[model samples]
Target chain A: MQWLTIYKKECLESARNYKWVWVPLVFILFCIMDPLTTYYLPQILESTGGLPDGATFDIPTPPAANVFMMSISQINTLGVLVIALITMGTIAGERKSGVAELILVKPVSYTAYVTAKWAAHVTLVLLSIFVGLIASWYYVQLLFGDVSFIHALSTAGFYGLYIIFVISISLFMNTWTKTPGLVLFLTISIIMILNLVTSVFSHLLEWSPTNITSYLPSLLRTGEVGQDLWLASLFTIVTIVLLLFGAIQTLKRKEIV
Target chain B: MIQLKNLTKTFDKQYAVKNITFNLPSGKCVALLGPNGAGKTTTLKMIAGLMHPTSGQVELANGVKGDIRKYIGYLPQHPQFHSWMTGMEFLHYVARLSHIPKHESQKLAEQLLDRVGIADAKNRKISKYSGGMKQRLGIAQAMIHKPSVLLLDEPVSALDPIGRRDVLNLMEELKQETTLLYSTHILGDAEEASDEILLMHKGAIVESGSLQDVKERHQVDKITLRFDGNMKAYKEKMEEFPFVTHTDIQKQKIHVYVQNVPEARDVLLELVSKEQWPLLFFEVGQTTLEDLFMKVVNEHAMADHL
Candidate 1:
């Protein structure tokens, strides 16, 4: 009941601050732009640039699945930035402003406090991802070709797992530090470094959470679930749980001034 | 009832709150009196379960120990609320966190708003409220759960005079319903509101007792005499008397600390009449709480140097 109460407050906070509206809108913008730009590149280039007299450009439209992958790449960069901006102040701001001191003095447990924040963030992340993916799916069908609903769902679901992992890491970092700017920097840098390492050494880190992003486009195209995909999903889920646990412990030991 | 047994907190190898022990009786108002950085906030934080003690423990009624935050309500030195939330909504959120049922939390929030005299501004965002209104709201939120023990840290320190009066009056009313422990550096506020006082210095309690008892124990009998002209000879003659234990002279006035006020009064009156001393004013008085506080603190400082 305590966690539910805190979770509801978090939900109301996000809604009132228009985070629910703006975050999803940003995601949808990225989603729509990803495919539209890919489809209209030649026309855009011709309108913007004066070509030489005999220059003729030929550009082919990519496959529907490839457009979805382009959207994933857009989210991998801009979407993560948006998420970081949205959640950078979740715990650290509360602590700095002394709100955390008031709430922590109540009868609530540390686990409930951390979990409630995680749940609220997960809700926002999932809603934003779902809205963006559905919009991307609709445009991919119109601009490219007919894309299977099941494949699109699988792609979104796989990508959603990676987003959740990033959010969990952010929350963990927030609990560990008092500076919101530092937390945001550390979380983004850590995730970026991990993704780079896993991608550069994919042969050695096949089961890393970053592999979820790499497998998402393939899963959308072929509609096949691989053993490594399953292993990566498991690893992501375990890492999320472990990060949340670590956050709770860190908060428990934190000296709230 | 709550008992702090040798509670200590250290930060970066420095003791914020040293090993301190005290018991708070139920339904009584106790004031934690100390200067700034004297560990009052640290002690309250440890009791509120916001910070774990480096050593020792806080034992509640029935000897139940470990996270007794449920039985305690705490307001920090500067209580911060979600500025975007209406006063009523914030109280409702606090009630829920206090484990009140959802259906009843709304009613409790409304009742507490009225109780703390913030009902008129209950619908206003906290950002729009004045300093006093916000403090009243803080008290409303802290009382929403009806905890047995209430702890407030410098609740009136940041307020204007009117705000301080309003909070102190509200505290007076609340002290009757629950055990209250408030920390403050203002001796007048503590003297006006608390029945018992725990005077802390350098992270340790230098004095603790009922207000009347502590005042009585440290009270010194004294007399003051002011002259219209220079009274150097008169002051020297008065200092030779056996009854006058100490004398402080400022300009033409002499403040004489005495062993027996009646005996000193008689001796001083006879001397002033015989020598035709220029006695412009005279009065006898006992030491006030302020004087006792200064004396105790000065003695401790001197002893520390030794």
Candidate 2:
């Protein structure tokens, strides 16, 4: 695609400046902190056992899966917020900074620009999730025995899709709003709307973007790709298409004054 | 060549750009001059394909297919960039949008960042960059693709003198590779940089030509001579002549306005023969850009007033 140049550039920048240097440092620190906190929480709870149902602890025996899951929560789990922050800067920040006018003038169409943004964001998000997962995997092995590794890897696939879906949704929100604060607020509002609506219609809503929000948790809860997994995938794809199309059109047609 | 034929851009019932026909040839800069809301930017946007003209075609030269955008570099009135991106990242992202290969995007982006003089600050996040720095990065991103037509709308309005000079110099440098279509009300800039001026007033081109050619429109040979007696009769008589456009009698002086002063002088010499009037002063005033602008605006305003 015409957007590949921008996409690759985004990947390199994100890798070098965004996570390659930042996430691992943060995650490694969390790696220590996560286990240390988990390890000591039980003792702390036991010491404070005199309190009525206070300081009750459910600390996991430092297993690979537990460390990995904790690491995922610490690093990759900011998926929504991180992706939202990244996407908001893509279109909204550019527009606000007045760089859009300059770029749009150069033989780049609104479609190509928007698509490039979508692709760059998706690539970054996927990389972030994968890198964090891999890091967690490494730490998990260091912490617990290899036996704790999820024997069925299908769950990871479902989780990967779910996280990517969250990223796509975040990018879509970024495109819709150029203000970071607004996108942040909008992302939360959208997630809340989807979650609230889907929860109300729990078993009925199949093709809702919000359902994809649970795709990761669902895989963790149920090892198989349930109705929610397929439904979430479907919802994410459809919404991504529609939102990206709208973003492209808006970008192409709007004057960058 | 960029030909906008009858390019009408209407918002609601108010026609922002009404039946605009203009030709921007390759390798020539066309300065779009107008007051606020005169539709200069709208017309430029239509050419840049940022806004679709309500009714008309923005046809590019040589029938370039699949969106003429590849051939165009547009610097909007206000440039924007991804906040999370550095000045360098902004260019990189634009390189991707331009279809530059992944392997080459970084080199090209770095090159552009250097070209725009933001190389030192390239690593700084765009949100942290200054307005002029952001604009420089904006220019870098727009030029990264080396497009054929560069559309710069008020490209220097935000910059300080140095930034403006850099941007202007960059424009001059870019002209070696691409045509520059700049839009601004700053007549001095139009005079300094543009090969031609497209004067827009009231949603239409009141004048379009080389600066000199446009200045010719308001060129007038004016002379005033005092009559021995009342000059009202002479003023009245001068107006009757087809050659005399405007004649006024103020106190004892008779003022005569003519297209060709020398020829009008010859005619006035004949008038001297017929009736004796004290010759006062004669001067030829060539039109300036400001004069042309005023003349066109006044003519249009008068027409509308009528």
lDDT of 2 at A211: 56
lDDT of 1 by residue, B1-306 (tens): 998999988889988888899999888999999878889999998888888899999999777767788888888887899999999899989899988998899998988888888899999999999878888888887788888999999999989998899899989999889999999999999999999999998788889999999998988998989987676767788899988877777556787889998888998899889988778999999878887776667777888899
Tens digit of lDDT per residue, candidate 2, span B1-306?
Answer: 788889998889898999999889888877898877789888888887767878988888798654788877777676656667677767766777777876799999888888888789988888898889877876776687887788887888778999888988887788778888888887777888888899898889878888777766656666777756566776787887777877655556665767777778888788877775565654445445765675677678889899
The CAPRI-style docking tier of model 2 reads acceptable
CA lDDT scores, all candidates in order: 0.88, 0.70
Report how far off residue A5 is in candidate 2 (Å): 2.2
Task: Give the per-residue lDDT of model 2 (tens digit) for A18-65.
Answer: 555664454355435565566566667668754465555354585444
RMSD (Cα, Å) of model 1? 2.5
Off by over 4 Å in 1: B225-254, B266-281
The TM-score obtained by model 1 is 0.94
Pairs that collide in candidate 1 are none
What does DockQ give for each predicted structure?
0.77, 0.38
True contacts kept of 2: 0.75
